[model samples]
Target: MTTDILIEHRRDIADLKQRIKNRRLQVLGLFGTPIVLAVVLLVWAGLKISFWLHSDTPSAINNILGGVVAFLVLSVIVQLVAEFSEDFDVWRDRKTSVRELNLQLSLAEERHILEARRRTPPSMDRQASYKERLPGEIARLRYESQHYRRVHLLMQWLLFVSSSAISAVTAWYDPPQPAKGVLIGLGFTVTVITAAAGYFKPRERAFNLQQTADSIEQHATALELGIAPYNAMEEASNLELFATTVEGLRADQRMREQQLDQPQQGQQHVI
Candidate 1:
């Protein structure tokens, strides 16, 4: 049975690996599309300005400047879209991985329970020992999840700051007339806000992921240590509880993926 369980786990892991790879490719495509579009638009805008450059009037120069600014703005929007798509893909992959890991652990635990039940009465204490190991496994998973979240958050913040600086420099170099400046400023402000929100949004998710992992670890530890409620439960009941916990985690993970995929109000592509 343990061998069978291990085989199943390996299959599941392989499936997850494939899924993640597919998602990554999809995300690359999503980001790539806007960059291609931006390049095309940029070329078109450049040609338009080149044609306008022949005229010597201030109005002609302003028209060229306006066209250039518009292209820049569109480029920023494309980049934001790409960023959002990448984030969504990453979040979904992480959530799915976590869910699958939890499920695997649960299945392993169930296998242990089954083996213990088949043992002679004198060997029941060995089952308890097996259970004791569960807490450590859970704790390790929680730590890993926390680290992943921290790294992801840091990357996002860096992207936001870099984008904002670029926008600021662009604004300064091309200081527009008062009216135009106001419009450009508004657009810049919107971009900054979106980036800021995107940077911070993952922190909450990180915390939640950590908390859930911790909870599972604690529950497993309690069960193993013959503590309180878990200690009182029969083998069947304990198995049921473990199954339920895994199911809940899976559901939560799916929900998170859906939420991450949902379009945000100010979502924009920056490419």
Candidate 2:
């Protein structure tokens, strides 16, 4: 664990933790999408009823149709978004079977590795060397992790602002019918986007990927520091152990990924 390696490890873990929190918030925000839309629809329904009670048949009918049209369009958008979002979750898994081969790296040796790495030239490419050799599975996992983290907040805000606009349109303002229709359409679009978020499960997937990545990093560090079984072993033996451990982690990650294809229970949330 040279200074560069330790620094890279800290950066990676910190990024993962922060991303996990953001993704979770996005998930919650997504679950809130439909709930918000439904509330808006209910309010519209009440408005329509009130109009009918006052003998305003045409206005009442138009209001009801506007709400219905918005709801349907929103549903379509939700499905489309959900379909794409599925590809973005960073699923991961782990295996305990490989524990037998792991060298129980001690704190002292770990410190020495960091000190040695720090003493090395600042230009050393330790992080690159490890990542350059990354297998396809790990590469895919990395892509998903980054993709979800970047998109989560964007999606959350998109839904929030879009839905809020619909709630803002009201009898109090007496917005023109055309303006009302557009607002309703916007509501539907945002609702669908939010609903799709609920369907895709990005938060769970990102978490799994982060966990698997962490495991790989820890094991690789153990080997780098010559700790435990990796410590006493020949270079050739250590490489073999390292290879098998990474493969095991990948296998577990793949297994966890299979669940994304399964049907998920419908969820509703309120902001």
For this target, which candidate reaches the highest TM-score against the unseen true structure?
2
The CA root-mean-square deviation of candidate 2, after full C-alpha superposition on the true structure, stands at 22.1
Q: lDDT score, residue 199, model 2?
A: 69
Please give each candidate's TM-score.
Answer: 0.37, 0.44
- Write candidate 1's Cα lDDT for 1-271 as tens digits: 6556556756665666566565566556556756765776676567657775575536765576668667666765664554466545434443234456556556665765665456434435444444556556567657766876876666666656656665665667675566456556656765765665565566656666677777776667666676755665577566556556655774676566456545664333311
| Candidate 2 per-residue lDDT over residues 1-271, each given as its tens digit | 4556667656655555554555454454455666766776676678668766666657656777687768756864664465345564332211111222122223334554666666764322443354447655466777788787666667788878877777776634578887788687977889788777776767667878878877887777787788976775456666666777787888887766666645553221110
Over 4 Å off in model 2, which ranges? 1-132, 135-140, 265-271
The C-alpha RMSD of each candidate to the native structure, in angstroms, is 16.3, 22.1
Local error of candidate 1 at 76, Å?
A: 44
**So what's the TM-score on candidate 2?**
0.44
- Which candidate wins on lDDT? 2
lDDT of 1: 0.60
Cα miss at 153, model 2 (Å)?
Answer: 1.9
